[model samples]
Target: MSLPVLLLVILALAAIAYVTGRGRAFRTASGDIRQLHSLPAYYGWNAALSVLLPALVVLLLWISIQPVVINNSVSALISEESVAESSLDLVLSDVRRVADGLDMAVETGALSAADARSLTSTGTDVRALLGSVGVALGSDVSEETLDAAQRYRGMSSYGAILRSVLVLAVGIGGFVIGFRASHKDFRARNTVERVVLGILIAAASIAILTTLGIALSLIFNTVEFFKVYPAADFFFGLTWSPSFGGGSELGIVPLIWATLYISLIALAVAVPVGLFAAIYLSEYAGSAVRAVAKPLLEVLAGIPTIVYGLFALLTVGPLLVDIFGQGGLLGLGWMKGGTAVMTAGLVMGIMLIPFVSSLSDDIINAVPQAMRDGSLGLGATHSETVKQVILPAALPGIVGAILLAASRAIGETMIVVLGAGAAARLSLNPFEAMTTVTAKIVSQLTGDADFASPEALVAFALGMTLFIITLGLNVFALYIVRKYREQYD
Candidate 1:
């Protein structure tokens, strides 16, 4: 059976188990629910959980393990000489693709089951036949590859049959156990609650575990990079030039400066405008005005950064150059090109405006109305109340909103790539074309360099640095929130 069909059967079995267990509970208690330890629904849920969880777990494990076993077994049959023409992994990938193509041809009725089993690459146009069925093979299939692919399909078919039988048997066993245990005094509710708590804990730990995995990977690669390239030069060198060949500077200082410079410029534009808009929406705007205006302002955040990058590249870049470049509008000749730090910063700031505005608006609204009333009652003007009382109460949350916006600005890639030129340097001039750490990370990894070399490994180091910077920002934001938060209750 197919995986989906098998899954549906398991669910049907669990449902039947639920109904049976509930009926058995009622019969055991002599139709007197008062005599039961728990409710009828609890008994039903306990049986459902007992049968469903084990079956799903087994199904997941079988699906994951079957592929590894089949791949190893099939790959072992592929001759070393056949793989010498190409990489073993690449040849194996082609083998799997050929297997899939044959399956599709059979499913579409293009090939008879008997002919498919007897077919060989020696006489047949395997690639052409596969292309006809819309499963294009990447390379011509050799006899060895064809043999391996057939084995792969056979093993997979056998595994699927075995998986279906085993899953159903385990599910039935669990159902029998649960159904027999549904007695009048069984703590069905407690058992169900414990299982649910375990599921919840697993769900919660997913993010923490994923983050740990990422951190470890980055740390390992960063260590590999530092072993070949001096850590001091990477951290403190003034230049940023990475050559696939030796003698690459691979300095991060200039890139770090550019990142901070652009981020600061972006925040300078975003924080004030977004905060003012938030204050007006929360304090001054009418109900209808607030409702319409807030969503409209937030629509800026929904725009893709690529569109913003295009705007920076085609629209804003030329506009700035027209005004600021060599003797044009204001007779100023400071700017040379359109792509510069200022261009990306302006576009990034516009994109981040809604993030700051929406969050700050929510934070400001969360401040108790009594603070505003008390300030006004003390003969302070509405403006004074907002400036003094409301703003102070909402400072922690507003700081959080601003810091989050900063994070967004710092990590942005597309806008920096298209708007900021690919030059990494330290310059006081905002008009100078420069790149950030994220842009350089992309450039370094995509370059023609060996993955084992320091050049490509440096991407991991850059990633680690960026992580540390963002982590510091978050830690500071948390400290600010905890230290200043008002306990209104």
Candidate 2:
């Protein structure tokens, strides 16, 4: 049976268990709910959870293990000599795909089940037959591969059958146990609450474990990268030119410099405009104006960064080049093309404006009105009151908002890729093309570079560096917020 169908069956069984358990609980309490220690719904939940959780666990475990088992068993059948230099993974993937296609053909009545089971049937080109039935194999299947695929199909079918039986049996048994345990003296509410708490803890642990896993993976790969390429050159060397061939310079300084320069320009354009916009909306605008204007401004946030990159590439970059390029007004000859640092920085700044304004508006509004009132009552003008009282009160949060936006700008890939040119260069002129660490990471991992090679592994080091920089920015922002933020009792 399909996974979704099995899940639906499990849910149906759980529903039945819930109804039966609730009914049994009422009978045990002699149809008087007050006689029971907990509500009928609690008893129902206890039974429902008992049936669902174990069955779901079994299903998940089976789904995860079945693929690994099948892959190992089928891969063992394909001899290393037969595979030549091709990846075992790729061969196994082809085997699985062909097997799945054969199964589909059998299901759709294009190929009989008996014919699918026996590949040695007279005059039958299995690959051609499969292709006629819409299963396109990359090449003619060898005899050994065809045999392995057949074994894979048989094992998968048996495994599915066994899995369905085990899941259903566990669900029924759990329902029986839970229903029998449902009585007047049973603490159904406490049991159900504990189950819920366990689920919540599991969810929280998944997030933490996922982050730790990512960090460990990055660290392992970075260590490997340094083993092949000197750490000093990777971190401190000024050039970044990676060739799959040996003796290539693998410095990250140029990428880091461009990343920081673009981020600084973005912050310079974003901070003042977003902060001022927040001040206008929060402290000065009327209710109707605030409602209309705030949402309209925040609409920029919903637009994807790719769209902004297009805006930069198609509209802003060309306009700037026309204004600043040779034979233009002022004729500076500074910008030669549409892709440059200024183009990306300006669009990124525009993209970050909504983030800053939204967060800063909330922070500004969070400042106590009494502080504003007291400052104004002391004969301070509205501007002075906002500048002296409200802004000061919200300064830490505003700083946090700016740093968060900065981190985003630093990590952004699509805008930098499409707006700023991909050449990793360190230059003082904003009109010159540049690239960031994220873009380099993408470029390094792509193409025909071997995974074990320094060229490919450098991507991990670049990723780890970007991760650390963003992490440090976040930590600093939190420290500033905690150290200077005022408490309102």
Candidate 3:
């Protein structure tokens, strides 16, 4: 059956169920709902769901399997001799293209009368052959053949009308059924609650499924990549280069070192500033001060990373060049490149300050007031109390926040792309040029290199490595935070 017909059937059943349920719930001797087992609405909902859910499931399954089945049948009918010369996969692809072309022609009203007749005759012959084969095999003809046979069984104006009517009937039935069940006796509250819970659970499951899908895709592609490029070269080779041509080497050491160097510089800039900001806000700031400072701090987080990248490129880079470049003050001409690890790190650190401070501030505020009072009561100064009692109590949480920030810095792309040099260098100088893994991945993947090539496949390997590193950091941070939370509790 056509998609419309299937949908119509489902909707009609649901509507019928709903109307029936509501009628059962609401039909009263005195037209009053005070004596019902549940509300009239609940019965209607239950009945509608009963009718709709099963039919919808069946329809979904049918739709999901139909294309594959039909494609296979079409492939079989095209003759094994035609495909034997080429690969089966290539033949299947050609069959699909032919099917798609016919569909497009029909949709656009572009098929000649002669062509349409020929196609119809071919379709009929194929369907009959498939049915005979299925029967001879003593099994149900393949679902594909069966579907195709049914589809080509007729071509009349009423076929479209029938499909439409089926869909309309299903929808109307479901609505009527639901309405009928919406009676005083129906348990509407319970029914609605169940539905809400199901929706929430489905949404949660989707998030988890999406994460798993991404991880699996990365793993699959990386495995394929490793088949072409040795794991040792990818992981530990000192030189970093990925050529798109047949001869390519995909070493990751320089990229890894660059990533580490950038992250370290970012942390070095962020930790001290963010820590100080958190201390001041949590310990010293009054309500009014906090109200102003907190939003301003959050505003920093709200700024787009791209904006930070531009700032790094246009503003910070030139400033650095003037101060430390070939003709700058103190005459340290070694710092020539305006865009370097230091520039990217510094901008990235500024971008991450809010994340670190916001988290640390919350943890600091959660520290027991009693601890501070006790330290002060023991003759410690206010600063001493905070230093000795509060900071220690909040240390784990602060560490967790910092680790999260480190992950952010590592994964950051725009800032490094804009400010960090593209050269994959192993220099120790912060002022020298460098490139990071993310930059290389973006550069390599955006071009027209074949996906099956080792050069292109290397991007997947890099992505997998990035995923593992970030995943580990987040998990460790969570573990430490949980441990610290338990301690405080």
Candidate 4:
């Protein structure tokens, strides 16, 4: 059976187990649920989980192990000549691809089983045959490769059959054990709760481990990059040119400079406007106006960044060029073209405004009404109370909101790619084209460069740099909030 069909069959078995277990519990209780140790539903669920969980575990283990075993067995058929011509991994991939393609051809009736078994690279154009079934090959099929592919297909077919049998056997055994365990005295609810808790803990551990795995991957690759290219050059050097050939300048200084410059301009636009809107909505605006205005302001947040980037590229960038470019509205000639640092920064700042305003509005509203009333009772004006009492109390949260917006601005990619040009340089002019670390990371990993080369590996170093900068922002924002929170309370 196919994998999905096998899972559906297992689920059907579990459903039968559920009914059998529930009936067994009902019979054991003498048709009185009050006499049972747990609820009737718990007994059914306990049995169903038993049939589902063990079968899934076995199915997963079998699926993961089957390919490795088959690959190893077929690897022996690959000749040393093929390995010398191309890497072993690449040759093995071609073998697997050919095997899969043949399987597809047979299943789709493009090639019959008898014809597929008798086919050879000498007598048949194997690439053309596979291509007829929608599998494209990059090169001509070799004799050893075709043989290895045949072996691979045979082993995989047998392995899949064995897997189905073992998984079904395990599922049946689980059903029997769980059905027998369902008795009037059995603690079915406790058992079900323990299983659920175990699942939740496993899920939590998987998330944390996934994050740790990402950190470790970046660290290992960044270490490899630094070992090849000098760490000093990668960190403090002035340029950011990476060539596929040797003797590339892999400095990060210019990228970091542009990143900070764009982020600063974004924050300058987002912070004041967002904070003021938040103040008005929270403190001064009528309820109807606040309802209409807040959601309208927040609507900007729902628009995807790519859409915003398109606006930057098609609309905002051109507008800026008309205003600031040579022989235009002002005749200043400061801007040369549509793509520039100012264009990206302005668009990014516009995107960040909703993030800042929504967070600040919520934080400002969270300040106690008693605080505002107390200042007013002391003959203070409404504006004076907001400035002296409410603002101080909510300053920490506002700072957090601003820093969160800053983090998003710093990490933005599409707006930078579409609005600012891709020239990685350190310059004082905001109108000049520049690039950020995130954009460079994308450029470096793409194209025909070898994966092991420093040029490609530098993307990891760039990613790690962005990770550190964002992490530092979070830590600093947290510190500021905690420090001032204690003082205010």
Best prediction by TM-score: 2
Write the number of the candidate with greater TM-score, choosing between 2 and 4.
Answer: 2
Question: Looking at model 2, which ten-residue stretch has the lowest summed lDDT?
Answer: 480-489
Quote the RMSD, in angstroms, for model 4.
2.5
lDDT per residue as tens, model 2, 244-283: 8888898899999999999998999999999999999998
Between which residue pairs do clashes occur in model 2?
Answer: none
Compared with the true structure, what per-residue lDDT tens digits does model 3 show for residues 319-382? 8888888888857786787899889999999999998999999999999888888888899999
Backbone clash pairs in model 2 (N, Cα, C under 3 Å; residues 3+ apart or in different chains), count: 0
Predicted structure 2: lDDT: 0.90
Task: Report the lDDT tens digits of candidate 4 across residue range 402-436.
Answer: 88888898899999999888999999999999999
Rank by TM-score, highest first. Answer: 2, 1, 4, 3
User: Model 3 scores what on Cα lDDT?
Assistant: 0.75
**Model 3 reaches what TM-score against the true structure?**
0.73
> Please, what is the TM-score per model?
0.93, 0.95, 0.73, 0.92
Candidate 2's TM-score reads 0.95
- TM-score of model 1 (CA atoms): 0.93
lDDT of 1 at 6: 95
Higher-scoring candidate on lDDT, 2 or 3: 2
lDDT of 1: 0.90
In candidate 1, position 478 carries an lDDT of 68
Candidate 3 Cα RMSD (Å): 9.0
